[model samples]
Target: MIRTVVVAGALLLGIGVVAAQQDALKSAQAIMKANGKSLGGVLGPMNKGEKPYDQAAVNEALNTLDDTAKKLPTMFPESIKGMKAEGDYSPSSKIWEDKAGFTASIATFAKTVTDAKASVKDLNTLKAAFPAIGKSCGGCHETFRVKNS
Candidate 1:
């Protein structure tokens, strides 16, 4: 009876840990999605030339992206790789398996955002810098993120 109780307790503890990891994953994914929305809101109109670019809006969006980039690497700790919760987008296992590579990609993205933020003084500069920043993001996503369809 004692052995059975101990086994049951261990199982419950494992489940709890998985649940916590799933929750963390969900939170991280949500942050990334929100950041993406912010980027899209600013960049979409700029790209389409639908309206005159607003420097203040570009700066604000880049700041948000930079902040999120800084947080991205730490968000996907090893424990949460395969775990999923409601609305969670699971990262590729490559993130944990090739952690060094993943970290480098994130560092590159952060640097790209920083450089873009620094160089974006006017609409023309922003238009020039945005594509490079986007490429950096796309490179990381191609490797570390799962494609949702």
Candidate 2:
């Protein structure tokens, strides 16, 4: 009876750990998506001249992106996959297979965001630099993300 109880306790503990990891993964992904949306909110209006460009908001968004980029590599530890999160979005297995490449891509994106934050004094500068940022995001997604089916 003691052996059975111990086994059951171990199983429950394992399930709890898995659930916690999944929760962490979900939180991380949500933060990333929110940061992306925040950046988009800043960029879209400036791009279309729908509103006067807010340099402070742009800088804040870029900084958030940079911060997120720094955390990103560690966020997708190999164990994150196969965990059940409520969201359908997940990292591609290619991330683990080409960890170096994934890290490099994120590093490049972070650098671009830093540069943009430093140099974007006006709309024209943003226009010139934003596409590179967008490309960096696209490149990473193309190589390392799998959209929900």
Question: Using Cα atoms with residue i matched to residue i, what is each candidate's TM-score against the true structure?
Answer: 0.84, 0.89
Please, what are the lDDT tens digits per residue for candidate 2 over residues 1-149?
A: 99999999999999998877887788778877867775577776786687788888887778778888888868877777655445666778888889899989989998888888888899999888888888887788889877776
Could you tell me the C-alpha RMSD of candidate 2 in Å? Answer: 1.7
Best by TM-score: 2
Instruction: Look at candidate 1 and give me any clashing residue pairs.
Output: none
For model 1, state the Cα shift of residue 89 in Å.
Answer: 4.5
What is the C-alpha local distance difference test score of each model?
0.81, 0.80
- For model 2, give the 10-residue run with minimal summed lDDT: 81-90
RMSD of candidates 1 onward, in order = 2.5, 1.7
Worst 10 residues of 1 by lDDT: 81-90
Candidate 2 whole-model C-alpha lDDT, 0 to 1: 0.80
